[model samples]
Target: MAAAMTRMLQLLLITTLIHVARGKVRVQITNMIGYKDDMNITCQSSDDDLGQHVLSYGQSMEWKFKPNFSKTTLFHCNARWCDVMRRIDFGAYEYMKDHYGCGSDCRWMFTIDGVYAYDSKTDSWDFRFSWYS
Candidate 1:
């Protein structure tokens, strides 16, 4: 009976973990610029604010998002340098899942000129960026 109880507990834990994992998405943003100037970063989707931060040279920030009822969600990050703003957008689930599985976390690196999304499987970056002054 004790052995059976232990197996049941393990199964329960696995199920709970899978449920929790499905509810959220994790992502990281890194600053690859050489300058010390701080960059203001903001992330939003479907008018919902995910987070905001300021990153200095070689700094990185990680954030998590819980998607709403929409499978087609738009996630965007904006980085400001002086008067210029560089914005990068991801289809959130579509892009992240294509590269990093929904159960896995993803990362992105930002440079002064562009942005790159990290692929953990290949250990490489896929450039994705847009600039606006």
Candidate 2:
């Protein structure tokens, strides 16, 4: 039966495409600083910075690709800067997200208080946190 043969082919095609692949991360991209763009959010797979992300906030969330900030420098972590970190600021927390989730599958988005633009080719967010501390 041609009809039966077609059904079998369709079933085979569906099964072939019904594959579940493992990924580097599984989380939502939060806009902590109101940055308007896709966030870079990183993943460390560690105890704390597990699914750590890198998001630039505000409309300025487009400065992450500047030739200046190639990496985020560790500026002493404090509980005070915890909630305040929500506010866009390039002073200290450069590329580090707020580290939202707790398990090895969570992370944070940045304020990108001083941003520039977003990258389309790749799902990466770029921006500058602030001009001053």
Please report, as a residue range, the 10-residue window in candidate 1 with the lowest summed lDDT.
93-102
Cα lDDT over the full model 2 = 0.34
**TM-score of each predicted structure versus truth:** 0.62, 0.22
Error of 1 at 8 (Å): 24
lDDT of 1 by residue, 46-114 (tens): 657867788888888776665444345457666765545445544533444432353447677777667
In candidate 2, what residue range of length 10 has the lowest lDDT sum? 59-68
- Which ranges in model 2 have alpha carbons more than 4 Å from their true place? 1-9, 20-25, 28-108, 112-120, 126-133
Q: How close is candidate 1 to the true structure, as a TM-score?
A: 0.62
Q: What would the TM-score be for candidate 2 when compared with the true structure?
A: 0.22
